[model samples]
Target: MSDGGDEGDDAESDDASAGTTHALRPLRTDLAPVVEAVEATGADAFVAVGDRFDDDLRYLTRFSGPDRPYALVVVPDGASGDDRENGADVGRAVCCAPALFDEQARREFVAGARARGDGEDDDPGDGEDPGDETNAHDGVAREVRTENVGDHAGERAAAAVAELVDGSDTDHTLLVPSSVPHDAAVYLERAGNELSSTDAVTAARARKTDAELDRLRRAQRATAAGMARAETVLADGEAGEDEAGRPVLRWEGAPLTTERLRREVNAALAARGVRDAGNTVIGAGPSAADLHYVGDEPVRPGETVLLDISPRGPDGYYGDMTRTFVVDGDGGWERRAYVAVESARETALAEVEPGVPAKTVHGEAAAELAAYGFDPNAGEGETGFTHGTGHGVGVSLHESPSLTGAGELRPGHVVTVEPGVYGPDVGGVRLEDLVVVTDDGYEILAEYPFGIVPEKRG
Candidate 1:
């Protein structure tokens, strides 16, 4: 995860340089498609208002500010005849952010634009440097100007957004995402501008850029490390008898509970510079049947132990991977379930090429499970393939291009390919891998072993 090399003898130096290098190489986001989307909406501009939690806004501005409200307004290019004559095909953007986040916004937004030479010739017209707080550049094809507001930043930012729409002479409609804050939408409407909700941002975010892919790969590598740590612990665990005279997994003379295993996995993720994002699922035996279970239970030997880790990286990208392991198995239900799930995973992954309907992937996985004698249509509280094959992963752990949805797979689409089976009486078996749709096929982001037996790493 440390950019593909050993930290070397001077760990401190490596850490310091890592931050420096990361700042220098900002993630490149293309806004041209978003601009075209805005134009297609028949709206003058696209306005998104939310805090850092709003993945749509974060995707547009790449500014990871605090939980306070911020706004971004995007206007399509060639708004004027002169601009069209000059061949300006990319749209323009403005970030109405809180005054407190000026520096961070400049570093994340303006600096990236400057690095990409996207705003070299643009004049701020305020005598301040282009990188100044008043006007910053966007690395995308468009020119992004930053406007800092203070005191009641949410309303003030909404007003700034209104001004952006009002300033345009020929256009007045403001397109916003459905997730836009209610107050912001109301303010925009009261400002005499018609507001419409559009899925343009969500559609654009489904396909990632090269830089985004790099961040995803880094996060997944960290996730794989976390899985390795958990697997190693499982491999090192000794078989022992519990107080009830039942078999239990013990590590270092202590019972290895799901909570303790999760801690070990999380620690490994943190060491690799990623946070678990509260999605690290470690379940054993009957608990494994409860898909999203986050409980602490005994890890009995010869039972299924499902580990599903989805961690978020520093750049706000997520990595998701799941693997099931069984210790001292007697080749019974767990083994059969593992084989079926692995086969279903392969069937799902093979359908991950561009232009393929996302639902086809899920159908294939389901069919494979059914072929293995597991009911693909098992209802709630019943055992079999119980969930979708996978979902897209990015800024939000689950985003667009869902495998169970009607959307078609496209290149640059990063999605998980997880096929799982569950039964309360036996347990669960799941195999997952993060993959990105490629021009011809797909590429698995990380490679980890697949087996019922946990593998130990040095």
Candidate 2:
């Protein structure tokens, strides 16, 4: 259930020149509806303490960075006809960054705007000259300005919020997302402005734009490639006797461990320019029954191997998929469980559509599982089907509007439909697919064939 993150000290990057390109929809177009929603709540401005890891902030600003640079962006309301239409007024979407990393912030800010399909041509000098701060975004409806907040960025952001509130009524509130740091929240609250959580901002991000879908598609393609590699290794594994004279699976004259399979999958994903960010789950034998187990034991033939890989692409969007395969599997309970889980996944996916309650989707999968003689509630810990049917996937591997419970599915909502059953004696069987909710149905992103065993390639 938990995803992995990069280890080591975080440092700021060199300058604007170190920036990388990302695919994005127009920033203003994405934020317009969000701002309107926030404004309806009586809030005058929306603020997010953004970084490369902040998906909500990245959705609004399109400013993912190479540096772990913290930035604050303020979007105020009620500027002009065009500005109101676009949500934030042009040149008023204020971005504040540390003085040392201001150039990187500026590069991300402008790159986001330029990447928008509706925006004018990109300025060739955007990266070369970071000092020339322009109020206009050139081709888009709104503009962004980057400023250095000096030493204390949070205090500066509070002051900026104070300025916005002062210009308007004294009752003006600044909307912040749930990820805002406690100290930052306190500073903004102490600055005489009311602080509020805006679900609108985060909810807006659950829906994928066309540009986002492309990145997700590419990411899933890479994930499918990794799955093929893992299955290949499993297929090539040969039955043998271990040092203890027990049965085991060997690949290339060596015992195949879960860690070895995981490494192989990771290598394949890395070759495709995708990183797992620690959500790669490779478990085999009885360990697979634990769901989250990253198995370390030597794999044995005829035991189920559950491989779940959710890798993030270069564009920051994530692709999640899970499949179970048997190493020259024993044809018995494993085959039955695999068929049940696969059927449950299909049942759940068929229920996905705009306006459908998420709980209904989960119910469909559960019903299918139960129909196949697998009860979701009968298992204590490692029996029957376990966990939610699905969850939203986007910039973050898991997001809001879970398919396990209430919440209406909408178009642009991308989610994972995973149905599984586990038992200590029989290992586990699980099938997961990433899909986008459509008006009438859903579009599957992970296109790899769902097979219980892989055929050796020519």
Candidate 3:
């Protein structure tokens, strides 16, 4: 188990009166990294379409709403007519959203643009003075321009992109991130701009900033509280009998069904202002043997219940964690499986750090599970350690630098080290924790106990 130490304070920010309000700090998106990534791909510009649902768009522009109503283009800045000649590495991001959200986007854009260490009224005196570098290329918000595309969001966005491509003296090819919708990609292609994968953007997002890490930590704390509530329910659960006189677990004198447990867990998360992104798995017994199973049977004593919750915080970041428990403290095969899973989890976590291959971490966990007398590489139909070791978590539940033991781990990267062993006869045991990759080591963000059974509440 990792140390549950205080990482820092929770991040909270004022909303810009849009469809959704972010309680976390403004996204500190530096275009320099994106520009460099795009430049390396030999593309003159990079475009991201869709609304906040697309994490890439939200990460860069924070434009989220029920309706996807925006497209963003990043280009290099240059003097009036000869921008291509300037060939500056810095980028100027232009956001095109529907007029409906124009005012809100404007407010958000300006607020995010404020330079650090400078007051709101800090000015460079006169325009001719060139001494004020605050408006320099590094300032993402100031260099950003938002345009309103009357009604047709995608078509208008394509038109705006066409204009940008035609105006630029450089290559008209624009790189679109994988998250962009097919229709949006078609629009860009039809507009005469060639499109390619925005792999670099994905790589850039894998590394979180200080502010992003803070939001993730806060989200995980809320998740841990929700987990604690689940534990309390389990701890208070009494041994009982179902209609067939079979053994079961009951809470508050009611039989605890998987659906009931799911509702309660979601309610707990909701109480903390977190929205259930729908992947809240509360599986029991045989159903628990199958990964991603949405259990519906009544939870029974002496059986393991796997709880995996990935909730979206008010700030749009996600907190992913999982824990397996046996109600009423059954000390049989379930507990043994839990211990093995925890060992594998710790082993994998120790391998997390900068410059290490992500697959190496997964391999370590698999090895630990194998040493525990379980098969880490069972056949397709067999029950063993199933699924990947872990995955990167951020605005999207599963992002980049996957922990299949392949990608290179880097500082700012946040991932879960979840290891599990599932079987039809013994059920399953899985544990997960969110952690941030550090320069020298890793820090656990999900600050909660790793016990399989919950202590009785006072």
Candidate 4:
């Protein structure tokens, strides 16, 4: 939906990470345009009468309270809590706080919220302690009127929205987002069939806020340490079994293994209050060649390994990065390919800027790859490097404002710049980093040393 085109790559993602946001954190400046756009779209006071599990939910309403796994409403303040069966802007958002997203599942959820003895006394600030894990001055968790309210996610949400819509005395329209699951849509319809779909929510998340960027940067810096630690594990020597007989990676026998290293990185990030969900991208030999490969095969001497580490930043901000290294020593065509990737990567980076289109950057990288001895476009039995130059990185590993194929670059965007040369014959070599786009230029979020000189191949 953004002006950016698809890069010749496949980096699909879903909003699965559980994130927490702090209050008094500058309200997202980007969200304003979206709310304005929503109002302009002829919708009455905008109703994100759906679930809260994706980036849009986090971006629009700051609904990062304890995980409820259900549907919600992004109703703006000054809205009424009454129903608008005919659709009204009563200036309040009514939400059913269910735990699931099924249709029949959510109706019961709304019934539960209505059945509560303190139903009239509900408030978002009940048990929430924003100072705990949230960063906002007006914490979303602290604003909870219904925590763990029901079993059906979207149904509960629709019931709450329907009630608000009916109660409101002003004529208003209800809006839903494309991110809402179809099942949830059915639930909203069942409630009264009054839900309308729109792209406002996702469009708002496409661009990020300053406070979000700050947290993303910090999370990325922590990821750098994790990446360095993974490389450091390989830097020690061949990965083998330890005295305990576990297949551990030994950095001078201090104790290292794919699993152990994974725990270490998570431990490192957790110490900084950043919880993680996935394993570090430490793949060895052929496995490393595959993008996003998460296996943990031990690294043997004289083999190339890829280390792509993406860790969560404070709240829900995510940091993504990639670096390739050889175990024992560097040699053969591997080193040459790494140099090629680094060149292609920089070539792309050089073209990145506010006014410049994203296409130029990908084109430059592709051109550099073609100019190199490696084949940028190979087919069938013989192919080298088949992926995009980069993509957007934020709440999710891949978000918006991509850097692939062809697309216009915009300010306030954060994207990755990774280029690679992969093939069955030559394995793979790639380097990636997170960058923030400014009005004139961009800044790299993840910092690492490029072009490592191997003393010898193990």
TM-score of each: 0.87, 0.85, 0.85, 0.72
Report the CA-based lDDT of candidate 3 relative to the real structure. Answer: 0.71
Total clashing residue pairs per candidate?
0, 2, 4, 42
- Looking at model 1, the pairs that clash are none
Q: Which residue runs of candidate 1 sit more than 4 Å off their true CA positions?
A: 1-25, 80-89, 115-154, 166-171
Residue-level lDDT of model 3, residues 1-458, one tens digit each, is 24533343221111211133344444656766676666677777778888767778787765555275577777654333255345433556667756566555654543445454454334322223221223432533232334445544455655555565455333367777887888887766766677888676777788998778767876786677667667778888898998889999988878998888888778777766777778778888877777776768788888888888888875588888888888765587788788888888878888887889989999999999899888999754477787889898888898887898466898898998889998887578888888998888898885556677765421
Specify the poorest-scoring 10-residue window by lDDT in model 3. 9-18
Worst 10 residues of 1 by lDDT: 1-10
The residue ranges of model 4 lying beyond 4 angstroms of the native Cα positions read: 1-31, 49-52, 69-71, 74-156, 159-173, 192-196, 238-257, 328-330, 377-382, 405-407, 453-458
Cα lDDT for residue 327, candidate 4? 59
Best-to-worst ranking by lDDT: 1, 3, 2, 4
RMSD vs true structure, all candidates: 5.4, 7.3, 5.7, 10.0
Q: Between prediction 1 and prediction 3, which has the larger lDDT?
A: 1
lDDT of candidates 1 onward, in order: 0.76, 0.70, 0.71, 0.57
Better of 1 and 2 by TM-score: 1
Residue 266's lDDT in candidate 4: 72
lDDT of 2 by residue, 93-158 (tens): 556665455565565564444432334434434444443333334322333334544434455566
